[model samples]
Target chain A: MNYEAIVIGSSAGGLSALKSIIYNLPGNFSTPIIITQHVSSLSESYMAVFLNQLSQLVIKEADAGEKIKPGHVYIAPPNFHLLIEEDFTLNLTVDEKVNYSRPSIDILFETAALAFKRKLIGIILTGANNDGSNGIKQIKHFGGHTIAQLPASAEVPIMPQSAIDTGCVDKILSLEEITGYIISICH
Target chain B: MHLPDQLNNIQNIELTHFFELIFNVYGYDFRNYNKAHVKRRILNRINNLGLKSISELQHKVLHEEGFFDLILRDLSINVTEMYREPGFYKSLRNEIIPILRTYPYIKVWHAGCATGEEVYSFAILLQEEGLYDRSQIYATDFNPIVLETAKKAIYPVSKIKEYTLNYQKSGGKNSFSDYYVARYESVIFNQSLKKNIVFAEHNLVTDGVFAEVNLIICRNVLIYFNKELQNKVTGLFTESLIKGGYLGLGSKENLMFTDVFDQYQVVDAKEKIYKKTIFSSK
Candidate 1:
């Protein structure tokens, strides 16, 4: 399937995992990547800038109403639930924290699943919570692809393990395998 | 389209029809809200009430007496806290209050004021800065139930700790404890804070411009709106403000992405404070 968008979730121990995953994509990669990494509500805009410097993907914090474009990376701003509207534009919300986190993986994954349907891919990486587990299921329910990082290979295995527990996970690939699979399916 | 996709389309249609049923019967419009947000909230109501589907929910909403109020409350989640973003208020006290001092009389509208926590927060800040006497504050929310609750200024005592920390961080001049009397499970704020404040029902979706003011403190409210509604609300804010007036949005809310982007200059970038440009090319 030619996937148009990718939604990724990570929490504790997410930094290196995100870096390795981004490192695996080619310089000419051309699919939109949306990510939610758990950080303090006071976290700054530096994550996007730092990620952009290290990776080929053009990364920036998602601004409200910005059109979702291929080949770009959009990171959810701290303390806001980044939603995908029907028109494929971004909408940020200060709604109550879901799964005890704003920019909750479930909110992003579930909304993206509805918006992108079978054309979306959801990946769950190292984290401490089960925020993305239900989200990945929504993607799968909509006939989309779902992947969880191999628990043993993850810095924190609990998150991906939780996604695996859902039984909706399509694959539990190693970081390298995940990257290869993403490139193979996208664009 | 595939079967499930077609089914999804059907559900969407049902949801839109539900919105219209609501507007027609109640005269409260929600058709302009962000659809995904509306869909999720409606689905939550469906699941919570153990209803079979959105259409089922719609039937109950139309036929059952007072059922629409329950659904209305569900749609507008009054999930907010006092001094929610401390830094925004700190910036207001340090940067914006000085400018407001210039006016002999200042009018501030707390648009989408939610449950009025931030309205009281602003009042406290103004009182601390000694600007309360000359200020007229209008606090509004579409949810009338929350509006009444706001007028009482009572909050769960459980939230006091967080509000106290936020108060301190927001450069509060006095002990946070002094502002409210904590009795049992709730804390009642000082009644004097409500003196210059008027709490009313103002729906950002359908309400017209009601006040021409020096500042509009609407934070974190516009995120619920789609691109079109966001622009419309921003335009209302523009028309509501006097020339060169101030608008403070939530930290994550961007004034730059809207069609009205050029109409305002950033007054405090970090705090998301914008000043209406005196002369607009548009």
Candidate 2:
């Protein structure tokens, strides 16, 4: 099968960036997308509501043990780490933060790597920290396609730079191009 | 100590052995857990301890004093908060509360209670609903360290804001601040909330039925286990509950694939609350 899932991670300055890509996706873009964006725990479930208003696809905060479905976006809520279980269901953990970030992009990407294996696309976007670098590496190790946002195009370059440094990034593209590229590869 | 930049397939063997070591030594059976989660947690411990490989970490785990606790904590994965998934709590207050009121005395078992945030949150809800006097809540976790913290019921004042929002969303009728007293950097919840609570050690994996509770709340805990363990824990939950008693799982958890799938009737499917039927479907 082709790519079954796409996992994206962002940190500081992630909200607007995520909106730009998610809102721009074509109506038929149905591959399941999972996102982990660093935010204060105080944000609660507001991020899901905010993103749902922008994207045409069904968007909601991921809950533990929810079955993963195509044509929807699952956002990791603050103060929790999201993982993909063996059964392709979403799992949430209140486990200690990774890279000082709960809902760490790395955790979601790594688990999705195992769950989706070769049929996965891992994207690391703008974030001030190196949270998602190792995750994308894991994705690449599992033979999944890995993409990193071009550092110059990011609000914060450190995160993408770290992923690029791993030498595992298969492509580096602008958010606009990334959106178009995602639509291009699947169907 | 020669660590590669990337994990090779051969590393899977070492990791598997590490799980075996943990089970043999500590009796925490994580052999069949989701591999990605297991690997990540193992990698975390390896990095944290400045160890180079899983074998070395396993050696340390077997030989060192108190080293296993760190691994146990990592394995426990206790990231939880008050009034998580506000909708579920909302359903409990609006719908389950009335059913619970039918019982002269209520017993609730918060299996894998973590830091007792939910238990405390439920206590606050019970107090507000005037049901605290008639309730006995057993908050248990295999990780006694967290259980001790749960017993303390003190939380960083920083988290209270989000929790306050959750409380309001879950249909709190009173001021959220009334439940907690800000003291120093932490907030101390009212002692009365613990009046009906029993905090203790209970491992769902290895332990048996503890009580015939009216409700068993085991949210976000089952997802860590593999299918076999998940079913096993569900069986424990099924047996521990009285007939027609309730079982409230985490929002994403469902009875769809479990052995007890047909044994309970859905009370609120969205909220993952189920009531036991008279006959156990075996």
Candidate 3:
């Protein structure tokens, strides 16, 4: 699959899960990875900083109007919903929170689906809320690939379980398997 | 994942036509707005109203008397709060306020000041710094309904606690509770705070320069515009600001890639504050 972009959603026990996945990816990875990990609206991008130190991929908090590029991991900034424009530039909004979460996983996945369509891959990771459930459905509806972390293997299985329950997910893999699969399919 | 690419392209064409119809009939120019944002809002409206497509919505917009007004509200993303990004306000106090004090009379244009929370926040900051009497704030938004709410200056009482916390974080001098009168379910800002503010309906996309002010605080508004519109609006800001005036953008927004990059020097990088340099290029 010639994927152009990958949209990820995580919450609850997401930091370690993200660290495991992002650290294994090589510096030359071509797919631009965009992630939304649920955090407090008042929090900073310390998570990005911490993950960047452990990852080969260039990782940073996404800035509005920044262009999507290969080998860069963009984490959605705290307190703002991150969106991908059709031109591949990022946009941030302070619109009313959906499912009580700003930087809502669904918002990112749905927008990316519209932008990249069949060339996109949507992944749902560890989370307690059902924020990414509808997003996975939207991605499937838009003809984008969908993957959910294996609920049993997740730190907090509720999020991935909800996403799987949507009946739209294509694959459910453990953290290690998921990382290997992404590297395999992306190349 | 086998859907044809034409699905999105068809929706895109319909959306462009819908925006053109809106501009030609109502004069609210959203043609330059970010496509994803506009589409999401329009799609949400469609889902709620049980409409099929943008074409169906367009037909109702043309014939229905009050339908367009609802669409206008749907298009306007009015998510705002007092002291949004408290660090920006803190920077305003430590970095920008001292410079503002150098001037005898300060003029501030709060462009895209939706609901005027930040405008009042600025007014409060000026008051604390003893510059309120010498300041004039022009608070402008394209939406008249929001402008009306700005004039009323009332917000839900539930939000006061959050505002108070932001005030403290922003280095507020006095008790935040002192600034407002709490009614049953709402808090009305003190009448005195609004004395220096002039709320008006001025569209940034269509409106011309109304004043050459010392400061312009337009936060979180430019993210809705595409790159071309963003550059054009930043140019408008550059032209409206006096030499050496300050322009505070949303924390994520910057002028580094814009055409006006060379015209301003960085004041505070973390807060996205920039000061216009003398000797304009354009």
Candidate 4:
């Protein structure tokens, strides 16, 4: 399938895992990748900039009303839920936190699943919580592809293990295998 | 089209019909709001009501007494906190207040002021700067329920700790504790802070221009709107502000692609502060 977008969720021990996958993507990587990494409500994160330096994708914080584009990475801004509109643009909300997370992975994944349907790819990486388990199910329900970082390879295995428990993820791969699979599937 | 694609088209038509039913019957224009946000909210209501689709919900809305009110409450974004973005408030104090000091009397409008926490936060900032007496704050929201809460100026005591931290980070002049009286489980703000403030009902989507003002703070509200609604409300703001006035938006929102972008100059890009130009090409 020709995927249009990829949504990623990560939390504890996510920074290094993200670096590993993002740093390996080619300069010509064309699929748009949107991510939500659990950060403190007050943190002014530089994760996007930090990742951009070592990666080929043009990485930046996702702003409200932004149009999704190829060859770019959009990180959810702190203390806001990142939603995808039907037109493939971005919408941010200060709506009540889900699973005690403002930039909750479930919100992003569920909205993106509705927006992109079968043309979407969802990944759940290392984290301490089960925030993205329901979201991964939504993606699978919509016939989208789903992947979870192998729990044994993750720094905090609970997150990936939780997603695995949902029986929705299509692949369970290590960091290196995940990066390779993304490049092989995405055009 | 494939089966899923065909289903999506049908769903879109149903949603559009639902929005029209709401607008015509209730006179609230959520027609041009963001689709994802609206859909999420409506789905939540559907699940709660044990209804299957927007069609079913619409039927209940038309037949059941007071069901629309529940939907209205669900649609209205009432989530807010004092000093939500400390950097924006800090910039307001250091950059915008200095300019407002030049005017003899100042008028500020908090458009879409949900539940009024930020409204009181602004009032406290003005008081600390010794500009409270000269300033008039008109805080408004379309939801009367939230407006009533705003008038009371009381909030859960559980939120006080976070608000206090936010206040200090926003360069508050006095102890954050000094601003409120904690009574049991709620904290009521000082009456002095509400003296120069007026709370009212104003709908950004349907209401006309509110008032001529020197500053307008409509933060985090426009993200709920679609492009057309955003531009329309922004035009209203442009018509309401005096030349050289200020406009503070949510950190992510901007006039960059809007119809009024050229009329305002960015004062603090990071904080999303814009100053209306003295000479507009329009």
Candidate 5:
């Protein structure tokens, strides 16, 4: 399916993995990127600021009712679910926590799949839980592309392994290869 | 397996089972919660359901519709009271109310607000302070069904006597009974208390910031999370709060070990209240 957006979900080793992929994306990369990194309720927005320095892309915490833009990266603020809207805007909800996570990768991926349908690419990365598996299935069911970081290469493999075990993933690439794959698909 | 082995196995499988059950049926996440708490709650749920094993509880939940609802109530910690602790509310009135009065409008996030009693108590306090008209309270919880109960604003009338004592201790100016009507055995809180409250479902473990607010009150909820999850949640509140915004935590909660420790100074240490300090963006 042709994709205009990428939704990524990770935990545990997500920071380094995400940094690797974001760092590789060119400053001119035009597809929108959304991330749901597992975070605690007491966390600060330092992750956004930290990621902003790693890439030229605009990085900010997703705010309720904010618009999604290309060349920008939106990180889920701590303790709230972040979903994409059909209008290409961000919708923040205090809806039920998924997978014991507010910005649950599953919640983001599932909602994004419904919103973007086949025009989306869902990636499940390093983490210790099966948070993203069902979400990736939804992405595949919606006719979007689905990928997981190869468990052997992921810092924490449970999340990736869970996604792959769902039998819906189209590819399982390392963090370094994910950037190229995303670029190719979006282009 | 022996009891220890059985408990450990349940601990390991409980989260996975809970996660699957929530996603496939309820769409909620209990996967990353502190394992100890999850196990305890799951055990309590099993006992409540009169099941012999975790697998039995799981089977019942997966096969029996609406069983998830019962399990959710058992899993969720809803032990709360109006004017909880009294002292914290008193401190809020003494230290925070005056400051809030200066703003043209006030926004407060009462995170993990269970059953709505505490939210209603705060609303009554705000009304007594004459700040209700200018304030908006966003009462959020992970349990939407509980939130619906909160929105209903009803409680057992038997609890009102204790709530009255708490209200008085919390520096309430009028009789607590003024805010609710006693009907039969239940107390129906004044509908006006919810006028400015917006109830929504939010998971502190995975959700993002709600809004730029002057005050955030998340009590008792953080104790359910592990240190990593706690730190992440605190960071979200710190970022969502405006400069000089106030953060109030449960009495047992603290920021000493978090990355944001130096970013906030305790305002009323005894009350677990803090005021954010200006810091350079990371």
Candidate 6:
């Protein structure tokens, strides 16, 4: 399926996995990528700066009301939620903590499912909790594609295992292979 | 059945039933709330309603329409005061006021405002800062009954003594008694305080954004939502805040773990007041 946006949710041991997936993408890659990585609220913008340094894509923390652009990666800032609007702009809210997380994977995936519909692709990666399972279900219900990191290959298997157990995931791939799979599906 | 065990069992059963009923009938998702708190509140409601069992209270709630209103009050928190955590209000007055003063017209969303006390407190603060003339406050709560109570702006005169102390602690420049008149057992707040305030029913759980705003105050509400709901509401706030706008949470609430933390900088870290960053607009 062709997709305009790609959303990824990750928790423990996500950095290396994310590095492998993102490093493979060319700087000119046109799809808008949004990610939620568990981090402390007091955390700085190091992740965005680090990702930008590692990958060719323009990486930055998502801002409220900022328009989404192609070939850039938007990371949810620590402690707040990042939602995509139908108009392809970013909205930030301080509503509540979901799944005991502020930048909850569920919030990112669920809102993306609502706003992007079939044009969205949701990826659930390593984590301890079943945070991404319900979100994956919502994306599938919205006719969007869903993928999970292979439990065996994930740093923490519970999150991916949970998503896989939901029987909604369209793909379960190793971290190294995820980028190619994403490219293939988006094309 | 023994009373304690019966109440315990009834609490569990009624809570599950209430969760299912609210989800099915109203489509307001409360399934993932903190289970312990939800159960306690449910049990409290049963006792407050003077029902023998949770099942009996459940029956009343299901059969009688207005009973749900009382049930909602039991479920939703309404323990807010005018200047809760006086230090936070102090920070708002000192730090946030100057920023708000820059704008000619300001729109503020008081999400999850329970019983309107905090909304009036904010209105009063705006008045003191001379910003009330240009500000419009949209005070919203999920509980309609509470919204009505908020609109009335009436409270027990007994609570005013405590609230007056809070007002003074929060740097109020005027007499707290000057803002309200005591009639019988009730204190009627000045009507002018609510002139620019609009009280409405808005469920942060299921509602959409309320457009551009200069500041969004959603204190003490996030502690009740499960992580997923918390994130959802946070997203709503993020969507509603204008670039460089201010977002304030309960003193205990911090943006540390959410995806939007990097989007703001703590204006007063101790008070949980944050200023939206320019980079947030990206």
Cα lDDT computed for each candidate against the true fold: 0.89, 0.87, 0.92, 0.92, 0.82, 0.82
TM-score list, all predictions: 0.95, 0.83, 0.97, 0.97, 0.57, 0.57
Tens digit per residue, CA lDDT, model 5, A34-141: 999998754656899999998989988885456788888999987666776545766554445678886788878876875677788999999999998988997887
lDDT of 1 by residue, B1-282 (tens): 446577678889998898898888887788878777778878878889898778899889889998888988878857777887798999989888999999999999999887889999999998999999899999999999889999999999998988998999999999999899999999999998999999989988888999899999998888777778888999999999998789999887888878898988998888899999889642
lDDT of 6 by residue, A122-147 (tens): 99999888887888997897788999
What's the true lDDT of residue A37 in model 4? 94
Model 5: per-residue Cα lDDT over B164-190, one tens digit each: 988998999997778889999999998
Query: What are the clash counts of all predictions, listed in order?
Result: 0, 1, 0, 0, 33, 32
List each candidate's DockQ score. 0.62, 0.41, 0.74, 0.75, 0.01, 0.01
Alpha carbon lDDT at A26, candidate 4: 94
Worst 10 residues of 5 chain A by lDDT: A86-95
Q: By the TM-score metric, which is better: model 1 or model 6?
A: 1
> By lDDT, who's the top model here?
4
RMSD of 2: 3.9
Clashing pairs in 1: none
* Model 6 stretches astray by more than 4 angstroms: A1-187, B1-14, B47-57
The complex in candidate 2 yields a DockQ of: 0.41
Task: List candidate 2 stretches off by more than 4 Å.
Answer: A1-6, A11-34, A37-80, A85-90, A112-121, A127-130, A137-145, A151-170, A179-187, B1-7, B279-282
- The candidate, 4 or 5, that scores higher on TM-score is 4
Over 4 Å off, model 5? A1-187, B1-7, B10-26, B280-282
Candidate 4 residues lying further than 4 Å off, grouped into runs, are B1-7
Q: Model 6, residue B20: what's the lDDT?
A: 87
